[model samples]
Target: MSAQRKLSSIGGGQKTHQFVDDSNRFEELMRLGHSDVQIRVVKYGEESSGRRPLVILNSIDFPMPPSEQFCDRMWRARFRVVFIERPGFGTSTPLPGVLLQSETIRNGAASMAEAAILQEVFRRLALEDFVLLGMGSANSVCYRLAMICPMVALAIFSNAVFNQNILDVFRPNWFQAMLRQTIQSRAGLQIASFGVKYRLRRNPEGFYGQVLQKSAGDLGYLQNNLADFERGAELFQGIEAQTIEYDLNMSLKPDSLLKDGLFETTNAVAFSGLETTDHWKSQLNQEAKRLSIDVEYAPNGDLYAPYASPEFLLKVITDRLNRLGAAQSG
Candidate 1:
């Protein structure tokens, strides 16, 4: 059976498109390049909102920071948000065969396959046009999708990864190699799972603190909004051990989407933090220059700007969408 027909039956059309409780979101499978990738989609807000749907591209860590809160924030602004789970993240199927194959993961083939999957998603959802929101490493995927899927009317980026080489400069060279090997073996998965349990569930605060050190105030903010963290962690529930390995693997790969002039022809908006880690500064600037992206830097924002300054992020998004809508009508 074709993937579209299979998904239609699963969603039952009406049930598939209706607004559901947070816990009742639906997951469907789509065939992409010899692998069956899982995609869980949710439509937020009343259908009558008349706003273009928002499709969010998740990061390398796979839907980082839980999206329930983010979705709520968008929905409240009358935008319907679709949270896409990239292949190898959450319930999605991992790449077929050993993911550690340097040629496949580092060459850009994996990213191309992922972009094809996004194209299929646009067709299956019957999306005529929508806003594209790319978070973290997912920004690369979003950029690739925009190139292939014309249905994406606008693209929004948040702390995106334009050049992996810049990011690699900050990483401990040994750790990257070790992580790749660990994700390719069964025994390694078991060990990684044990580590994830301790970090994500047993002591999430400690885990988050280390990652949010540049945004210490944001970490404290998360402490008060722990529910968002808990929900974001759900994206990695069963796959934490594999997610890091896969994300890093992709990071090492060449990015065709970040090439010069890629975003010049597209309508896009970008946001980053003046307070972000020193490592990301050069990368952000280079990416912005390549596409002529005017980045809106937030004083109190960092990598966690999506969660730390939801109001600011939402305002920028909402205002841009409004402009797009008005332009379409005019």
Candidate 2:
């Protein structure tokens, strides 16, 4: 059967269709809220499995839909994996006035706006109880979701900086430091976004090479996995420049979801790459302690742990799910 026809047989009308050339996954553009913003949702695994949902928020740097390989792995593990493209990324419509006011972006309004959209997504998908998985900067949104979405049974972050100030405390490379400064003003962010788009369009391989150079571990993995690297570069290049600016603006700010008692009702864990700087590891450790969650280090892992250490990530996730199951049964 044709992919579209096959997907149509599964239900949900035109809103859901097979992802381009990928039979194992389907994408849906859901119209959400009064503003009629369209949120693109990608689904993996069989809905009939009745497994608890695994909702993933991918890193802003590569804010693309989950890969076919990743989706197959999750499906084999019996997870109904759903990847939601954050507002402004992928085909999802940007939140209204996302770039208009720096104050709104800084004062937690952006996070709240995203959280509200996510809440509606969960409702629409009937994801009453699910595990939340976040990668890198996207973990900031995960925090806001965990705070407001009572249905989040567990939250996991991979290579995330919970506190933006940690960059200052640890002092990243000059390039990384300068990248953070782009968010201080709308103009700076737009300019930086334009530069990124230009570089990706002009010479994608070089752009990705330069990007991965900072993390030897990730670079090595992608070097051996050329297909994955090319796919990622294509996705990264597909992101809109304005969306890039908005995503960075929200991610670079000090996380406002760290309010008192936010995680009291939520269970959370973190995974960090051993290849990351000691300062980053230190910050992850401290934040894990404050949140009263466990942290696991993936040997030879780096900032791109999601891409480079998928097996390790899966193992950690499976272990946690087993423990949660055990606790609930007990």
Candidate 3:
């Protein structure tokens, strides 16, 4: 069952979203086995021109479709962007018994389930070769996909969490640390997730303001691109609290993804902003070295590079694709 509608400006409670350019974007629900996965497909250029496909697994903090402006740039650069609203996020159904079990959440079974669903989704889309782009926590899913799905020709990650242990290096404040420990339990996680959802609904601006304070680059981008930031935040509010709880619990696991050697066979590159915290930079450097993959630092970029430094992101993609082409020809 699939349906399509023209993209248009929408108004939230107190905020008006006007930055999502009026473009030919449509949402479709893909029936995979017993569940339906919602996907937002935005095409930019001519299909007959052989535009490449870019599969975006959005970060947990920003689990929304890309802005029309961002999609337009990808289209102009000959790439079709597909945004997957993962299970329990948008209208998509959560995998059976995956999120309900604490054992699954703590053991990373949820991520493996997501990766399997994504692999099936790619096969149905007939995407034999596509670029996989992941941001933040979604990068774990990307690593898993690249290892299992041969269709992933190139994997690009931005501001990715290297492992669960890296969070320890952040040395969070006492209150933050307490909250993190509290969330280890199911009841505490539910309460925290609900609190976050409430904050996002009632005072998104303040919520995001506090969240981005650690990265000046992201904070400046949020201040400068309020409309764009708010647009994403509006979509962010729609995500289910259960989904947030599952992601948070999974991130706390010591053996999640990279820590278990899942990234060993992935063809990937990681990017971080130059102005990111020393803790993040140090972890990313160590992980990149351990994985033997390349890490590029974007000038004046940060956690919000997708929204703030689109040009730099595009340049990196274009250069990599060109190099791949040259290598194939040679």
Best by TM-score: 2
Cα lDDT tens digits, model 3, 1-330, are: 112333332221111112224454455555555434343333333334477888887776666666666777787877877777676664556656645476776677777888898887787666767888887767767777878898988898777766525555432353255357545665776666666667767877777777776667677766765665565666665666566666665554554456444455566788778866777788778877776678888776476666566788788888887887898799
lDDT of each: 0.61, 0.68, 0.66
Lowest summed-lDDT stretch of 10 residues in model 3? Answer: 10-19
Could you tally the backbone clashes for each prediction? 2, 0, 0
lDDT of candidate model 2 versus the reference: 0.68
Tell me which of candidates 2 and 3 scores higher on lDDT.
2
Instruction: Show pairs that collide, candidate 1.
Output: 65-232, 66-232
Q: Which scores greater on TM-score, model 1 or model 3? A: 3
Q: What is the descending TM-score order?
A: 2, 3, 1
lDDT tens digits, residue span 1-330, model 2: 122334342123235464644466677777654445677787775666787688988786666555676667766666677888777764677767754356776677776787788888888777967888887778777877876788988888777676535555322354465466576665676676667666766776676666666577677665665554455556665666555655666666566666544555567787777776677777778777776668888765476676566677678878877887899999
Write candidate 1's Cα lDDT for 1-330 as tens digits.
Answer: 011212244222221333233442333444433334455554444445676688776775435333456656766676667667676676566555554355655666666777886777677667767888787767766767777788988787877766635534322343344444554664665565566555667666665565566675466566776665565566566655545555655554456556677677777877776666566777777768876776777666565676567677777776776787898899
Q: Which candidate do you rate higher for lDDT, 1 or 3? A: 3
Who wins the lDDT comparison?
2
lDDT of the structure predicted as candidate 1: 0.61
